[model samples]
Target: MNATDRTPADLLGSALARDPAHPLVTFYDDATGERVELSVATFANWVAKTANLLQDDLGAEPGDRLALLLPAHWQTAVWLLACSATGVVADVGGDAARADLVVAGPDALDAARPCGGERVALALRPLGGRFPQPPEGFLDYAVEVPGQGDRFAPYAPVDPDAAALAVPAGSAGGPEELSGARVVERARADAAARGLAPGARVLSTLGYGDWAGLSAGLYAPLAAGASVVLCRNSAALAPEELARRVASEQVTHTAA
Candidate 1:
């Protein structure tokens, strides 16, 4: 697929088509010493299903704010894609402040409720064992996903000038809003310039929440139909572990 024909959804679809069975994301469960792998097809399907759930089940409309506070797990990828597919404005919020909707880990959810209260409409808890009880009106994400349809109709063509993400301004007292279409276009161009192509694997020492790292590490490779090997906090990993993961994953590029 050419750059002109690709959308965020199409990028994921291409990855699924190219390497349906290949592991797209791998994470270690420290408690069990178990490795969890999410394949390209599974990732794509969850993204689509989440998009449908947000739009159809939760009544999230285009331009509505959807704040994400989950860890850098497989679900983070799903939330990013689902927001793009449904045209909901995705905001990466810190532990404080109120957002229209919040997707968080159990601890974050509890902290947010006292701050946000009735202002928050939806509280999506991550899928795992022993999460905090959501307020009476909040919904369970695990149950919500199964109830949603398998697919979602794509949003109308996105406006290049419209705000798509609002990133927190590091201790600056305000967030920096960005244009989605512009970011996507620049990412595609950067990917092409860097020779990030299909089948190649890219790694990032920075977290996915960083603007440049997120664009280059996650979206850029996906835009080029390449695989991404993401580490939430690469700086925390031991040298041997990092080297082993890079070699095992066959990472070709590193963007810090």
Candidate 2:
């Protein structure tokens, strides 16, 4: 990370400033045989639009807690940075009832129903398609996000020391919470451990259910000015297919 990047959003901005056209996050759904790649500018646009939707449409404010029940898709990565931009604590797999807002995947809708706050759902489609039927008490994120402003300006400044993330107790790894500064610190450390350098292409098959997964699959590569190749349901891929993917994506590092 650069000297000025104390938060994930700042790290993203630095990446954007360095190379807006460079590919940032490339996502694959092994089960669906789908792939989507977003350049730095494209990813920033998505993050900005999502942040606007959270702040302007959903009325999210600094310190608000958002329960994010999503997977390792590109949209989930977008939501992470969006929450950072808006100062909303990203509670991954958190308690829905206590959230100020909830963003759930298709499988997570039922679990998110208890949230009294504004709720949104992602179809996790190949091209970000909307659900044929919106779940009860939830907005369609794909439909709502595209209409939001292209740029985001937070209503209030985020406190780097304030709580920024919560990894709920889970089977993967968990029951941990962190401040914004700590999140950045951890990401930086993970990048170093992963031996990620600028321009590195790191492939990760980690989920988004815990801090370890988030650090390896999203924050670490992003913090290092490297790009990510995030694969969901990767275990379903045959060995040959996985090898082909690594070769085709020009993967320089691997995190499983």
Candidate 3:
């Protein structure tokens, strides 16, 4: 692959080189009154552990589908990059039955029950809390990820032309497939179109099921060397609270 044929993992590596200490993902959960910030290095560490779990523990490989039934939390962002690092195709909001693995948020447990492959669940609580009792038929993400090695080394090279993402059904009139190279290209272009300045801090309240949402939440910010303040349940916040968050976080851009 050419140097220009970039993948999501490549973008993260560049961001770490540019400034590892800079905040890469600032997350807010309005319903729970939770706020968390992760620097590039910290986020990369999480990605590494998650990637190792996928490859070493779950035996996931390139072309294998991982259904991601998650919300727009910091952990979800971590999983997205983890999938990229391990060359697993992320099927956002896809049917669990058709996937090689199913990762579900707490609210999606019932929906994920029928998946035939490995199953993982995230509590999405503060500080990566695990479920009080592990969900039946599912491994808790917070419990499992921390125990994995912090450094990731894929068993094989990932193809830049291989499928990387599958958008949710009805998005872009139907599901859309994006290759690793195309994912990066679209991210950079979207960042440019949004006028994202280098190292800018952007706040977004978009889900990860569609192209625009995924770009704004993760890829576009990384592509522009910017950071993301991902807000979940933004609808539950008042206008004053939203404004206050933006001001407090020093956010330079907004996406909804």
Task: Write model 3 residue lDDT over 1-256, tens digit each, in one string.
Answer: 1245389998998888878999999998888889899999999999999999999889898999999999898999999999999899999998898899999999999889879999999999899999999999999998999988978888999897999988865734656889989999999889889999777999999988787889999999998899999999889888998999999999999999
- Where is model 1 more than 4 Å wrong at Cα? 5-7, 17-19, 28-34, 94-98, 114-137, 155-161, 171-173, 190-194, 233-236
User: What TM-score number comes out for model 1?
Assistant: 0.79
lDDT of 2 by residue, 146-244 (tens): 888888888888888888889866666645778888889989888988889999999999998877789888999998999999999989788898899
For model 1, residues 151-200, the per-residue Cα lDDT tens digits are 66765665545666666767767767666665577668878877887777
Question: Per-prediction count of colliding residue pairs?
Answer: 0, 0, 0
* Worst 10-residue lDDT window, candidate 3: 168-177
TM-score of each: 0.79, 0.97, 0.96
Model 2: residue 2 alpha-carbon error in angstroms? 1.6
Candidate 2 residue pairs that clash: none
lDDT of 3: 0.90
Off by over 4 Å in 3: 1-5, 169-174
Show the colliding residue pairs in model 1.
none
